[model samples]
Target: MQCPVWIFAACQSLNNWQQEAGSLPKIGVLAIQGDFLEHGKMLDAISMDWQEVRLPDQLDGLDGLIIPGGESTTIVQLMDIYGFRDTIKRRTREGMAVWGTCAGMIVIARKLLDKRPEPLGLMDIEVSRNAFGRQVDSFETEIHVASIPGDPVHAIFIRAPIVTNVGPEVEIIAEVEEGKPVAVRQDRLMATSFHPELTNDTRFHELFCKLSGS
Candidate 1:
């Protein structure tokens, strides 16, 4: 059978990455709340070192940041209390690659269907909170990302948000059905409505590392 184009690209990327293995990108996981440690472990599994970003100053020496899945309201409230909201927005615009998963996706959206905790409005996308039902409705499914190689990624959704629309600059990388974007990217910003850290797959994280330009 003919190998998929993405598989070839993945192999090439992995080879290039291995050649530069001596210098992997420095990554940070937002640690105020959510599954930050899980993301850190995933990075460790990929032989990458990462710091836990709690204060705004800690965000300084990072090539990329991962906002793990958690309660959006609680995380937003903590961000406000710890004065990370404005700084995060500022740094992100200054060319920091950020990947938001699940509730993190909700935090970066330009608009939310419900008017609750205001979003950071970093990514030009609209999201519907808990669109995949509630905690009881959480489930897993295989998702294919064109840029990632190998089999489809198994994603876990827990009180996950859904990407309803994306702006002109946003590129939809993965979807569940026709016109339903599940993962999107714009410049250095990437967001996914499911938790990839919850699984053993590291391709998504690797893709984010590449986007970080490190």
Candidate 2:
């Protein structure tokens, strides 16, 4: 893989990227479930300001929040139970950047291919829950994300979802060689099937920060 070139040159190093710009953003990680702590650690390594959101009140003053990977159905239920569903929808609509990985992709999708229930429907694309099936089927591949800071990103898909169909307005940042959409961006919102936090590919996350203006 030749790898897609990174868009933001300032993002050379995750930590100093913000310092070079002379600002650190108030980022958030949805703690509704699964692999969220790893995201937090990634944020820390990048030297950006962030917090874990578990309540409606935590939504205040956040530039953006990453909805980490996990079981899709459970995260939505938790969002509803915690009164964050509407808040999340409203916030993203109001221009608060939202980034979701795996199950998180399932949550923000406007339509789910599996006929499952409870997606927040913040984005205009359609998604498939566990489109690749169980974790045992997990695999790695090099992907091209035009907005990132390096060559082809080594994407690790663990029981990941696939974005089957996309709306006209969505920008495809990453895709498989077969041309399946894997990462997308619409205004302040972004979602990916693979987990960038699980790998050394800080470009995707860093590109997100650039796009998000955080």
Candidate 3:
């Protein structure tokens, strides 16, 4: 006897689910500061395996890492205190993917217009911190991203940074204004000026997971 169409479809769906579960990447969320818990919840919603990465050693075996939105200066300070600067760079060189959001973007940029906190110099982009003004000036808007399909993404900018310049390798994913980039990707590295974790959308997280080869 042949399987019914609906039964076949259900079997295929179950097989896909099993494959996805088997290939789920072990992601790490930087928990030294910021909204790491929110990112963890987002990962949970996607049914991806993830954990809070507090120390540099926690980075081991992680397919990807997320730097959550918070105080850029404080995040950088804690990173240095925990000896993460070199270790993270090394991991990235070894093909570990990284995604940064809001202040996390500021931490990973190659250059920052403001002089103070030292960036990890990961992504080849220059950023202007607080380009959208203070927390009170925070706003939400829908923007189209080149990599994400379907409708525009709902971006929440809270004291966001804007990409002042991008290198040849960097791909501009989304922008709020002409000539200003809010989301960018370079190989396995990604950065967003808005807090995607604060919104209901999981496309950005899905994109990062895909980029991580999960």
Clashes per model (N, Cα, C within 3 A): 0, 4, 0
Write model 2 residue lDDT over 1-214, tens digit each, in one string.
Answer: 1223332243345445555767766788999798999888766555567899989889878878899998888888888888998898777766789999988898899999877866888888999877777879899988777776457888999988889998999988888858888999988899999998887556666666765565
Q: What does the lDDT read for residue 154 in candidate 3?
A: 93
Please give the lDDT score at residue 29 for candidate 3: 98
Model 1, 78-125: lDDT tens digits are 999999988888788777889999999998889999966798999999
Return the clash pairs for model 3, or none: none
What local lDDT does model 3 show for residue 109?
95
Candidate 2 at 146: error in angstroms?
1.2
Compared with the true structure, what per-residue lDDT tens digits does model 3 show for residues 6-109?
Answer: 23433343346548766657889999999999998777666668999999999989999999999999999999999999999999999999999999999999
Global fold similarity of model 3 (TM-score): 0.90
* lDDT for each candidate structure: 0.84, 0.80, 0.88
Range of the 10 consecutive residues with the lowest summed lDDT in candidate 2 = 1-10
Which ten contiguous residues of candidate 1 have the minimum total lDDT?
Answer: 1-10
Query: What shift in Å separates residue 104 of candidate 3 from its native position after superposition?
Result: 0.7
The candidate that achieves the highest lDDT relative to the unseen native structure: 3
